[model samples]
Target: MAILFRRVALVQLAPRLGDVEYNLNLIEHGVQRARAQSAELVVFPELAVTGYFLKDMVSTVALRIDGPEVARLASLSRGLELIVGAVEESEDYRFFNSALYFRDGELTYIHRKVYLPTYGLFDEARYLARGDRIRCFSSALGRTAILICEDLWHPSTAYIAALDGAVALVCPSSSPLRGISEGKDHDDNAAYWELLNAVYAQTFGVFVVYVNRVGFEDGVGFWGGSEIVSPVGNRLAKAKYYEEDFVVADLSLKEPRRQRVQAPLLRDENLDLTIRELQRIQRCRGTLGHQECGESHADCEGETDAGLEER
Candidate 1:
C-alpha cells in the first residue's frame, strides 16, 4: 500500500442547536484555519451543523445528502479534507445522523451513524435511522472509516471496518458531561479513554482520531478529551476537558505499518468464527434456574450434553 498524507488537525467546536448559518460559517473558518497550519485533513465534532440537542427538529433541518449546505462546505474546502456532521436524508425518505467528507473542492463521502444510542441523554433511535453496514470512504489520505460517538464504545464496528480495508478510523462525537452534578464517585470519564486506547492498540492497530464536542447543553456539559491515538494505543495529543480548541498531530503511515508487522492482530483467528462457536457453546450450556446455578462443573457438563442431544 502507498503512504498517504502525514499531518491532520481536529477542530473541537462548541456549537449550539438550531443554528445552521453560524455553524456553516464556523466550519468554513475551521477549514481555513487548518489549511493555514498546513494540515491535510480537518475533523469537526459530531452534529456540529445543527447541534446535538435539537431533538425532534432534526427531521425538519435534516439536509439532503446533495443539498446546498454540503455544496457550500465542499466549495470552501479547497485545500483541506473536511469532515463535518449533519443530519442526512436517505433515498427512502428516512433521516440519519451523518457525516460528510469534503476534499479537493467536492464532497468525497458521507457516513450515516451505524449505532443509534438510546441510553441516558441520547434518544437517537427516536430521530435517526441506524445504518446496518460498515464502510470506508476513499480519501487522498488513505482508506478511512467514519464512526459516530457510540460506535467507538464497541469493538465490533472497528474490527469490521478494519477488515473492510480501513487503515484509519475517525470518530466524531457530541460527548455529554458527567460527574459534576452526580459528584466525585461518578467520574467514569476514563471509560472513554480506556475504550479509545483498546480500540487503537488491540483490534486494528490503525490511527484513531476522535473529535468531541465541548460546552454545556440542556444541563449536560460535554467532556472534551478530543484526542489522536496511535496504532499502539498511545495518545499522541489531546484537548483539555470542557474547553474549545484545535489539536494537530503529525502521524507517519509508517507507524501503523510497523506496529502491524510486529503484532498482526488483524490476521488472527477470525472473530466471526469465534463468536459463532461461543454462541454454540452457550446454547449447549442451557439456561439455569434462579438459585440452582453454582460452582458445580458436573451439573454444567450434564446440562450441556443433554442440550446437545436434544438439539
Candidate 2:
C-alpha cells in the first residue's frame, strides 16, 4: 500500500540575520502564498523565526517555548501545518536551537537540536545545550521525527528515531554553501550533502524533507537548495540555489513501509551489534580516546560524522 498525500510546500526563505520583524512578515506572507497554492504543509528554513547567525545576540532574541513569538506563530497557523526554527530559552536560562511544529492553529511539539556544531563558523556549543533523546512527534500525517541539520549526519540518531516509530523525518537547515554548486563538474561538498540525504532516506525507508535558508547573513552565505527525497533515495523536488522559492511535491508514506518490508534492514539486526561495529571502526581511528562505550558517553566533538551541513 502506498499512502500518498496531495502536496507539501517547502519554502526557501532568505532572512537577514537579527531582523525579527522582517522575518515574521516574510513568514506571514509566505504562508498566505502557500495557502493560495493549496499546500497541505508549509516548512521554513532553520532559524527562520529570528534568523540564523545570531552572533552574540542569540540570548537577546531567544524566546521561551510559550513566548509571544510562538504564540504569534500559533495564531498565524490557523489553517495549516507549519514547522519553523527558533532559539528556545529554558526557565533556568539555558538555551537551545529549537524547531517548533504547529498544526491547525495549535503548537504541537518542540524539537530541540541534539548535536551542536562548534567548528567551522558555528559556535553552537557556546550558545546552546544539546537535546538528550531522539523520538518522533505525533502528527496528522503520521509519526514524524525532526532533526536540525547536524542530526541527519549521524546514523544512530536516524536509526533510533525510526526505532521509535517515525514514518518520516523533517530536517530544517541553514546550509553554508558559499560558491556555485551547479554545472556537471561541481565541487564535492554539494555532492557530499546530496549523498548524505539520499543515504538517510534510503537506509531508513522514509520520506525526508530538508529545508534550507537562502542569501548571505553577516559574512556566511547560506546555500538554498532545499530538497525532498523519497524512500527509494531519489530526489523528488529541489528548490534552486541562491533563490527564494517554494517547491511542492506529493509524498507517499505508505511506500516506505512497503520498501522496508521488501528490504528487511530493520528486522535483520540488533542495535547493539551495529554499535559494536561502529566502535570497532572508531578504535581503529584511535578516536575512542574520549570513551563512548557506556550510557553516559563522552562529548561527540572531534570529527562528528559530517552532520548534515546546518553546522
Candidate 3:
C-alpha cells in the first residue's frame, strides 16, 4: 500500500500585542522555516497577527479579508498550505477572531471562532460578535477544519467537523496558563488539554493539530505546549513548554483510513437522533417550553417520552 502522508509544521510563537506588521514578519519567518523542512502545511497560533486580550483595541489591528495584510499572509502560502489566525473586520464593522486558510497562494477557507468565552479573564463576548457557522473545506491535505481556542472546548464543534468529513482538525489557540502547579513548572490545564485532544482524536478517528502561543501579555502568561495527535490517540509531535518552538510531524492518511475501518464511530453516528434530542431539549427550556409544547408549561414539564413520540 502507498503511504499517504503530509509533513505538517506547528509554529508556537509569542505574538506582539496589537502589532500586525511585527506579527506578520514573525509568521513569515515561520513559513520560511517550514519550507526549509519541506512541510506541506504550517499552522500558527490564534490571533497571531494581533495579540490576544485586546479590550477596546479590537478594531485597531483588524484586517479585512481582502486587505493588504491578508494578501501578505496569502503570499506566505506560496506552494504550501498556511493557516494563520487574525482579527477579521467585516463590512458591517464587526471584528472576529478568525483563522485564515491559504493554499497555493490563495485564500481558500476562513473559520471565525464560534464560542467566545465570557467568564473569568475572558471578556470576548463584550468586544466581539459571535460566529454561527462551522465548516470543513477542501485543502492540500484532504478535508480539514480550523477551530480556534474556546471553540474546541465544545464537543459539538468537533462533532460537526467530523460529520462534515474533516480528516484533520486544526486548532489555533491563545490559551493563558492558569494556576501554577508548585514544582511542576506547568499548570494543571496542560493535563486537561492533553486528555481533551486525545479524546477528540481517538473518538472522532481524525488527526488533531493544536498550535498554541507562548509569552506574557499584560502580566498573564500563555503556555506553549503545542502538539499533534494521530487518529489512534498517539502524540506525533510536541513543542516546548513556556517557550517558542517549531513542531513538525508526519500525518499519514492511512491512520485515519485504518481507524475508520476498525472503529467506524463517525459512520455510525445518528444525526437524526441528535437533532431530535436537541430540538426536544430546546422545547423543554424557558419560554420555548410554554410556546413550543402546544400546551401549558406544567403539562410540558410533566410530559412523558411516549407523548413526545406521539407528537
Task: Identify the candidate with maximal TM-score.
Answer: 3
For residue 24, model 1's alpha carbon misses the true position, in angstroms, by 0.9
Q: Order the candidate numbers by lDDT, best to worst.
A: 3, 2, 1
The alpha-carbon lDDT assigned to residue 60 of candidate 1 equals 81
Q: After superposition, how far is residue 146 of candidate 3 from its true place, in Å?
A: 0.9
Which RMSD does model 3 reach against the true structure?
3.6
Clashes of each: 1, 0, 0
Per-residue alpha-carbon lDDT of candidate 2 for residues 1-311, written as tens digits (9 for 90 to 100):
44567467898999867877788889989888888888877889888978877878888888877688888888878888889888889888888888889998988888899998888888888878888778798764588899998888787888888877776789999878744555644334456677888888888787788998888876667767789888887788898876898888877657687779877787775878878867767755554554355322333343454565648
lDDT of 1 by residue, 1-311 (tens): 77544788888888877778888888888888888899888899899898897787987888886788878988877876888999888889898888888897888788888898897778899888987777898764478899888887777788778887777889889988654444432236635454765566546878888888887878878777788888877787787777888888887777677778888877774878878866865765554442156444433344545689899
Ranking by TM-score: 3, 2, 1
Evaluated against the true structure, the overall lDDT of model 1 is: 0.79
What is the lDDT for 216 in model 1?
81
Would you give me the overall lDDT of model 3?
A: 0.90
True-vs-predicted CA distance for residue 37, candidate 3, Å: 0.5
lDDT of 3 by residue, 182-221 (tens): 6776787776788899999999988999999999999999
Question: Which of 2 and 3 is ahead in TM-score?
Answer: 3
What lDDT does candidate 3 reach at residue 307? 89
Q: Per-model C-alpha lDDT, please?
A: 0.79, 0.80, 0.90
- Best-performing candidate as measured by lDDT: 3
